[model samples]
Target: MSLPVNIDEYSRLVVLDDNELQAQNVAVSVRERLQRLRGIYAYWLQFPSKFDKEIVDYDMKKFKVGRAQAYDDLHLTQILMGNLQQASKEFMRWKINRDLEEDLRLARQRGDLRAAASIEKNRIMNNRTDKDDEPELEFDKIVPQQFEMTDDPTVIGIQKVPGLRDRIRKLEKKYGDTKIEDADYEEIKEEHDGNGTGS
Candidate 1:
């Protein structure tokens, strides 16, 4: 018997192929094409019905199906298209989450301990209610003048002072040797001798 040109007839034709391998191959090809067509149909359904005839004509040509077959095919195609779209959206969300987790793991393994801790803290904070804790000030807000310019001579002369040997010697003697009474050499020697410690 000849295959029916309609979708219902096409299904019957699938059952009649004598070569099982050929039938399976055709079925796989048709199903794959049908999935792609469904995706297109999902997008097309977003358009107004005034373009129905245009859409139908386009599908018939695109799928190489007869007019009668195209009519029923469009409906089934639309249902599959909707499902595929949802699946695609869900897959994208899952993929994004997986990628973020991988990046976090790599950051931790690379000794970026602060970054790993921040990620974990963010995740924990995100799961809590707004009232759970007070919001902490952001780094930029806490130190608003961090990047601002200063006119202090100490700031301007910082680079120049390092190269001045005389100034460094004077500053070092004045500041570096200014020790507390508790840090006197005699007190240190007495403590060390009493403890019978050798340096």
Candidate 2:
């Protein structure tokens, strides 16, 4: 297809080419030009008589055309500026709507319809929770307890008197000194008892 000449059309072309960088650059240029055009219109509106002649002269120089041609160019530029302004407004609205929809979806997922409605209504402003507004719970409160026991001494000890060493074998297995052979024990005992004389 043939390429377009209008700024908006050219921006769409850049976007459709799948070159985001080029598209963004074109959009920035278009936005700057649109802002400049709007400013000119505002100034002309405020001081029509003072600006009209200069605007016509500038247009004539820019397009290298006659007075009628300059008028046509200015009309077309105004129309394009209006369209750009509407497009920008629509883009902003779309972004806000999309964000609200996502927030509602998340709130629904978390089972909070009130939160979803608040978000939709734009009532949920602050993200931080107030300490005073939060509910107070007795987290440190303690409850009384009773216990029963069975024939197993280990279970009985644990239930009746917690932390009692219920099994000597298990305790020894865990942290006692290493077991000594009979010969090693006798040699150690003899040295300790001072029964060993100078060799």
Query: Estimated TM-score per prediction?
Result: 0.24, 0.26
Residue-level lDDT tens digits of model 1 in 1-199: 1122346634444334336535556566555445435534654756534243566677677767655445545544544334444455567656765665777899888999888887666544444433466563232222222356764457656554455777877899888885657653553443455667964
Model 2 poorest 10 in a row by lDDT:
136-145
Clashing residue pairs in candidate 2 are none
Residues 136-177 of candidate 2 have per-residue lDDT tens digits of: 322223232445665556563545445445676579878787
Q: CA lDDT of each candidate? A: 0.54, 0.53
Clashing pairs in 1: none
